[model samples]
Target: MENQSKKVTLFTPVKLGKFELAHRIVLPPLTRMRTVNGFIPNDWMVEYYSQRATKGGFLVTEGTVINETGHGYYGAPGIYTDEQVAGWKKVTAAVHEKGGIIFNQLFHVGRQSHRSLQPNGAEPIGASAIPHEDLVFTQQGWVPAEPNRALETAEVKALVKDYHQAALRAMEAGFDGVELHGANGYLIDQFLQDGTNHRTDAYGGSMENRVRLMIEVLEAMVDVWGSDAVGIRLGPSGTFNSMSDSDPIALFGYAAERLNELDLAYLHLIEPRINGNIEIADGLEPVASMHLRGIFKNKMIAAGGFDQAKAEDILEKGYADMVAFGRHFIANPDLVFRFKNGIPLASYDRETFYGGNEKGYTDYAFYEAYADA
Candidate 1:
């Protein structure tokens, strides 16, 4: 047992913001569409999280829409309504019961959303009127992304207010902290990327103007949660939802420097490899994480198709303070233990990953249980 424990570097404890994690293995935000109608977290969702909340480990909830208009995918949870906040309380209580730390990932789909999911069938909004040619999964099945209208300068303040109010609700829901979904070509990413944001306003054009909205939202969230209790996720080179920056090195390097000024809890960076897995763009260099590693003067998290060896290497080299696991955690509720003991992970069925009941969600057997059987 001692030998097993000593072999894994991921078992080491670290402090993230106000919470101290027992280990570096994090359950990153995954969009599992299993919430009840009206977008409330249900008992099933509570069980799902409780089963995976390793003692002293960190877990971030699925990408939860911040408001009604932020809804895009079916079954994703929301943090806007009183009922939704109350529903999430159960989830937070369960995780806390297991001595686990959880964060709510506040999300806004922006131009990536379909009109049917928008407020009163209204057109989706973005930094500009640019329409994403990609398709988004909705209740009616996959459909073409609706052309989005540019947010009026006045409306931008309201959008920031939405993020602020959502963070407040997250606190009421008992989350340890909140992570702004500034990655994955969502609303925040739309504003951050030049291809998606082409307006000649205060929010677009130069790299400084492009990063303004994200910084404003981060500042607003900081007002509610304090700098230590807030975190931001950035995909400096991610191409998901067809996102790309003209010069990721300059844009994200600046963003990291700016975010450092806020003293954020951590900067969760999606490695270029993970973003490339979704869409491999030629000449796309994976240097943002490495470059920002030197710039961001805070805890850094590196996530993307990482295995045990790679995670250990990154941590040992000080590339990241923590390593977040997605697919590995999905199929192994006792993932931390498995990694510590060198147990093989059960393969997950991709078909049942989203919009499903408990079959593929909580039914994955634990290491002990599977071995005993």
Candidate 2:
């Protein structure tokens, strides 16, 4: 038993805030575009998440809309309604039945949204009037929407309340914790990005000001769920939603340092790269994350193009405490096992990667089901 316990490399116990994770592997938040209506969790979502739960590691739910105005997808889950909380409760309960922990990732797409997805006649609100050059999937097909009115100071305060309410809803839905989706050019990311945020109010004009709303949101969530049960994800140099910063290093380094001061559960960071996997180039060797990781003594999770060899090497060198698997987790529910046993990975179906049925979502076979005996 002692040898078995000591030999558990990937299954080691790690402290993520108040929860003790049985493994250091995490299932990153992935958007499947499977929601049926404004914002509601479906049975397929329950099956999809429960299937991906690792016996040891943690699982973060897909980016869930916090309000009707935040609804950017047709099939994304929401935390604004009573029924939505009940639906997610079923999901969390099922994962708990298998002895796994899960957190709800709160999200709001700002300029990356289309008019069809917006609530009522309200335009899509952003940190600035600079609209995204990307197309959002809508019932009317892909259409260009103008930049939205900048959120007034009162509106920003309301956003903080929305975050708090969402955290409470997450608890009601039986999540072990909640993660703020502060990445991928969402509302929070929009505010953080220099190109998106050109305001001169207290929410912009400086690095500290740009990060004010995020900090307020975090504080509100902490008030609802406590600091130990909260986590935040950030993409320092990502250009997802027409996002760009004059000093990416300064923006993210400051954000990480502040997160460290808060002593939250974990800080998830997406590596910087334009296309494909983040290469281990000498110039972009996670200098900012390392600096932030040094400042923040809590659990640090890194995502974006991590394979088995790279993941193992990072762990062995202690670059990050936990590694989040995105596409790998999508195709292989037993991703940790596959990595540990050196089994060949089943490639994910690009066709069913987004806005699809259950073909690529839940039909991926496990090792035992297709083992070469």
Candidate 3:
């Protein structure tokens, strides 16, 4: 027992803020479009989250928009409305019933949104008037992204309030914590990267100016949930959504230093190889976590294309405190049990991943039934 105590495995317990996590396998936010009216969590979502929840395990909901203007894709969940908060209560209750800790990921997908998805059919807002370089999924099907207008100086400040309000709503809905969706090419990332942010205002220019919006937004949420219950995700090396920076190491390193001030619950970093859901060239060694780990003092989570061996390796080396599995969790409801018992994960069907029913959402059986079959 003394020899085993020295080893840090996926099942090892760790304290994240005030909660004692039973295991280090975290369920990061995934954009599964299974919500109902007004992008509200439905009964299916309750079942979906409950299936994945285990006693003392951690789970984060899909990227849930904070307000009406935050929508980007069709059917993504939101928490800005009274009805939406009530809907989310069912989801949080389900996870808690299984003794799992769940956090809601507050999101706003900037230029990645379309005019049709925007409130009053207005142009989506971003750091600048930069048009998205790729297609965005909308109710009209996959269509070329419409150009976004630069957010007015006043509007940018108002967004910090939006994040705070959303954090409050998350608390009301019975969530243990909330994570800001600052990663990928969302509203926060648009301001953080120099390539997209060409503004001369206080919100843009140098690295300090570019990172202001993210910092303000984090502070706003921290005010509502406190730093201990709030976390942030950052994809410093992610180029998805046409995101680019002159120098990622310096940019993210500086951001990490700033994040230390908040003393956030954890800083989730995506691997350089992960471009959203797909994996790109992985010839490079683990860079983002390796560097940011030295800067960010709190627990760190490293995600993207990680298997059992790779996940364990980083944990053992003290590079990351946890590993988030997306595709595997989508296929294996009892992922913790499977990993503990050496059960092979079931293959996931990509076709049914988005905008789907029970086929890929909650029908993935538990390992006990799976083995019996």
Candidate 4:
């Protein structure tokens, strides 16, 4: 029992870009489809995030699409609309009021969308027209996603501009910073993965060429928010959205080494699993995210399947600077307090994880407050 209690040596301050984090705990981006139609933030979102503003590191909002054409799933937040920006401002304001730092994750789903979510029924856009066999959640139901029309060489430049504009809107909306949503087989990740990006252009083929779009998006965002206020998320081995790559080490290793030069705020990497299922891999192959720790010189945060003991060991071994947990924070809004006091976490109900009223969203009780009530 004594050894178990002393196993975790987790409580330590860390510097995340310009902000000094009080703890090495983070709230990774967890997409909860609770926004209004047209993807605007709402008062419920403000309260939802404010409730999770405990003493852990920082909280990143779920992926908020950059433009209307970038929209892929229904009820996700957006940064392209003035109304959406104003709505997010309320959320950011609430987080700040609670003495917590928050960042808006700018995203675009690309080929992972339906025609109904696009502009004038336009097909989703990707680096290539290769159709993926994944389903997109829509108002009707989960349906096979449409193949995206490949972006013309010139049109790709316009999409980068959308990321830049979204960065500007994030600042105007009172966010501490903007994190580029480059992970989870989204548009940016699609461009980075060789399996999906089979174009014979400057933005494909070789590793440098394949990473051009992501680098360009980073450059564009830096122009608006500066490097200090920007970060990126990468899921090199994530199989979510039916994603696969022949060689993720070659693909992501080259990317991590190259991105070290940017010196962005923090590089968030998702720990890989077999087909999005978090089971121990049978083989001892070096994990995609573990390799990134040495390659990326900036602050690094690791997410997926992180518990207190594991996070403490990883931190002690210098494998990661911070640890992010999504579902844990969802069930225990006062996660930091619970960890400090060694209180049990509230069990999360899977039934209300997605779209719903306040039952599972804002009604989760805090340890101290809920016990008192």
Top lDDT hit: 3
Cα lDDT tens digits for candidate 2, 1-373: 0123233345567878888788888999888877676457878888888887766569999899888888666677789999898889889988888788899999888777766788676688888887467656676544665467788888888988998998998998999999999988889998987978998999998999999999999998899888899999988788765678998888888887777667798888887742222243433465435556666677788787777666655666566778888888999987877876778998977677667677898888889943442
TM-score of each: 0.94, 0.92, 0.96, 0.93
Of models 3 and 4, which has the larger TM-score? 3
Predicted candidate 4 versus true structure: per-residue lDDT over 1-373, tens digit per residue: 0123233355676667778768877877877778866688988898899988854359899999999888777888899989999999999888888878898899999899999988898888987888679987677756889988888888888998999899999999999888988887889988898778888988888889989999999998889877887889988778887677778888888888778778798888887743442435534332655687768888778777776766777776666777887778888888877776778888887777766567788888887554453
| Model 4: lowest-lDDT 10 consecutive positions | 1-10
Question: Tens digits of per-residue lDDT for model 3 on 11-111?
Answer: 89988888999999998899988875689889999999998898999999999998888888888999999999999999999999999999999999988
lDDT rank, highest first? 3, 1, 4, 2
All candidates' lDDT scores? 0.86, 0.79, 0.88, 0.80
Score residue 1 of candidate 2 by CA lDDT: 8
Worst 10 residues of 3 by lDDT: 1-10
Off by over 4 Å in 1: 1-8, 276-286, 369-373
* True-vs-predicted CA distance for residue 130, candidate 3, Å: 1.5
lDDT of 1 at 268: 94
